[model samples]
Target: MSDTHRWVEIERVEPGVFRARNARGGELHVAGDGGELFTPVELLMVAIAACSAADVDVITSRRAEPEELRARVDAHKVRDETGNSLRDIQVTFTARFAEGEAGDAARAALPRAVQTSHDRSCTVSRTVEAGTPVQVLLA
Candidate 1:
């Protein structure tokens, strides 16, 4: 499917805090260190985790509806002469299914589902892996 045009407006609310508003009227609070909200890096990690979880959840549910699904993403950062950047990212997805053959089927599909999400699905993960380009405009 082709991606739709998406836009978000960001306005500074304070010295280090800003509010981001999407076309849907959703708002997100963003801030730098010492501010009260999620930092930019934290939000990036959250995006990755959420994207992967969504893909895995959908794929697994097709086989067997899961009682619970959780996803965690861990990132390692390094700052050196080369500059600061994330060195590694790891994602862990956990799911619980009903106690029956359905559960067994879900369990059996878990590994493959995760693999497919990481390797094929999950746009955020794929974009990060591809080193997506970013452009900043002054307004």
Candidate 2:
């Protein structure tokens, strides 16, 4: 196992807005419009979507010219007696390749990318599944 302690710092800018800054100096801005309760889960879902799309890009680039790609990630959380959390995530990926290509091969690649992301690529999903500490910061 790699003992590198990967760190992600998130700072709360408002009630439902947060800025996620990484150890490598990368940053992301996230927010929600409703109550303060829903924003965090949405952020996780966005992470899944983004990571899945990235995986898809990697898969497609190896075979053909990728013109466009998009992903939609949906999650369901089941609450227990103590109002704790149990989550189920599903990601739907849609991609469009450049014309005059083998459409079947391009179409087939989407599932492989989704599997790779869910099984290997997405860090947030892995961390959450492993019950790691997810730190929340208030600015």
Candidate 3:
């Protein structure tokens, strides 16, 4: 796989359901019916949040491991004449550290880590915030 290019192949598993496979053998199921699998919109939100969370964790965890860490993404799914889109997307993170000097160091680093991720390091959230044109073609 080329570093400059990322790709995933999605194949229909059944009506209203599909599986997306990456070159590294990662797979996720997407479904539009019955709420059994992750919907495409949810996957998008997950990607955005996970990217930032991973960035923040990698930076902060070096100081001290977090006792608890979680990330959540919220947005309005809008459908209108313009088409379906997400608006006012927000990613939130909750982190906790054990009581100790190392924990204090990590606690102090948390805000900066999150800020840096949101402002620069995280590609997914940055891309979403900056916006980009996605070109689709038949294959």
The global C-alpha lDDT for each of the candidates, from Candidate 1 onward, is 0.88, 0.73, 0.90
Which predicted model would earn the best lDDT? 3
Across 16-124, the per-residue lDDT of candidate 2 in tens digits comes to 7778899889987666663544466677777767876877788777777667788887776777787846466677767887665555577777777778777887776
Model 1, span 1-139: residue lDDT tens: 8887878888999888989999999999999883568988888899999998888888788889899899998999789998878878999887999988878888888998899989998888999999989998776
The clash numbers for all candidates, in the given order, read 0, 0, 0
133, model 1: CA deviation in Å? 1.5
Please state the error at residue 125 of candidate 1 in Å.
0.9
Best by TM-score: 3
lDDT of 3 by residue, 30-138 (tens): 9976387889889999999899899989987998889899999999999999999999998889999999999999999999999999898888988887888889898
Of 1 and 3, which scores higher on lDDT?
3
Candidate 2: where is the Cα deviation over 4 Å? 12-17, 30-38, 77-80, 84-86, 102-104, 130-139
